[model samples]
Target chain A: MQLLIGTQAVELDKEGFLKQLTDWNEEVAIKIAQQEHIQLTAAHWEIIELLRKFYQLYELSPSMRALVKHTEQTLGAEKGRSVYLLQLFPPSPAKLACKIAGLPKPLNCI
Target chain B: MTTNNKSITCKKLLFISRHAPYGTSLAKEALDAILAASAYDQNLSLLFMDDGVFQLLSAQDPSDLEQKNFAAMLPVLALYEIENIYVHFESLQARQITINELILDGVQVIDSKTICSLLTQQDQLLSF
Candidate 1:
């Protein structure tokens, strides 16, 4: 059983994924501000929020490779800098950022 | 020594980073947060593990790399009473750094166990 919001159907999960949303949001935001010298602008927030949504929907943070392709297509050209995202977050954005975001340090961060 | 109330009012920010100062913006950013919190009278501490220990390695030659001279900032931390600087023992051993090779005064060198203990004492922790 799942709930519906707008055109989308949100799944009701037996898994613990729902418990992690708030923590994941705050951690990644704070980390970006502290680690990358990024002030967490509205633009930056979009990526993490999208990542979290995708995580909740799919149960995993996307790979940088996956995220870049997704960001390029969805966010338009100004936001598709895989290199910039990597430079800003380092290694993998989904792994590190998502971990700080509190969704369980995406297995790849280590 | 002037930090926003955010630092002192909060329990602690256990900052962990693995990059050398000036290697990337991380060191400088960490310094800015520390100074901001210090201004607020926040008590802060740091541990340099892995590449981060390189930031404390004495006699930095920033001119050789054409980067800003940031080794100069390590000493001023004490002026702010931010005395809890620790460099991991294995990190130093792996890099062949002696206790004397680091530039900061009164810096502690501890094993992994001690570092783990310190983390447990902190109210909050962060990594970069």
Candidate 2:
């Protein structure tokens, strides 16, 4: 599948994750969030940026537990709880947040 | 009257890695399995021997190969609480790798005799 950002086609996998990491930009993130029915807020942007940084360091998207732990370490406890993450990205926080972040679906999420 | 006991027991599982990190998928596969097992709250230990010791060497950059740097994943082991990591002392010696060269901290270096005892203590052994 592909996402059209003003006539530029960005390739995506079956699950709507970016096939090319470089394809991701703020505009692309907004488009994907629209598809997932999420409005890109400052709160959401904070986690998206964090996930990108995490992938840069670990080279893999984190499971929910790892995400919470890493967030606690970086952002402190108030924003790191699963409840806060769930409020930003619902249903399945790790999977949904990662999809919008243009990262591969988190391994071990199921 | 008979009573039913419903307590679940966590099994002791040991993963023995014996291959180099990049040449094949064995090393990555072992790491994936270790992370998966951590969610089950099992008693997990990882032992690196032979070429597997290479997985822990610092300053690994796989960008030229277009592969994820395997050493980068080692720190996640601690995050998952899979803390019983071990390295074969003789294997490191044979490869001429020093303990300081490894990236992950708090790994125990054990000789063959200790490895034997560790193996015997495991409820299951997973080899890669």
Candidate closest to the true structure, highest DockQ: 2
Return the lDDT, model 1, position A26.
56
For model 2, the local distance difference test gives: 0.91
Q: Give candidate 1 regions above 4 Å deviation.
A: A1-110, B1-10
lDDT of each: 0.63, 0.91
lDDT string for model 1 (B1-128, tens) is 43776545766777786677875888766665564465444558878889888888768767777665556656656544677888899998998988788887788888999988999878677776
Give all TM-scores, in the order shown.
0.48, 0.92
Report per-candidate DockQ.
0.01, 0.69
The reply for model 2, stretches above 4 Å from the true place, is B1-9
lDDT of 2 by residue, A34-90 (tens): 999999999999999999999988888888888998999999999989999999999
How high a TM-score does candidate 1 get? 0.48
Which lDDT value does model 1 have at B82? 74
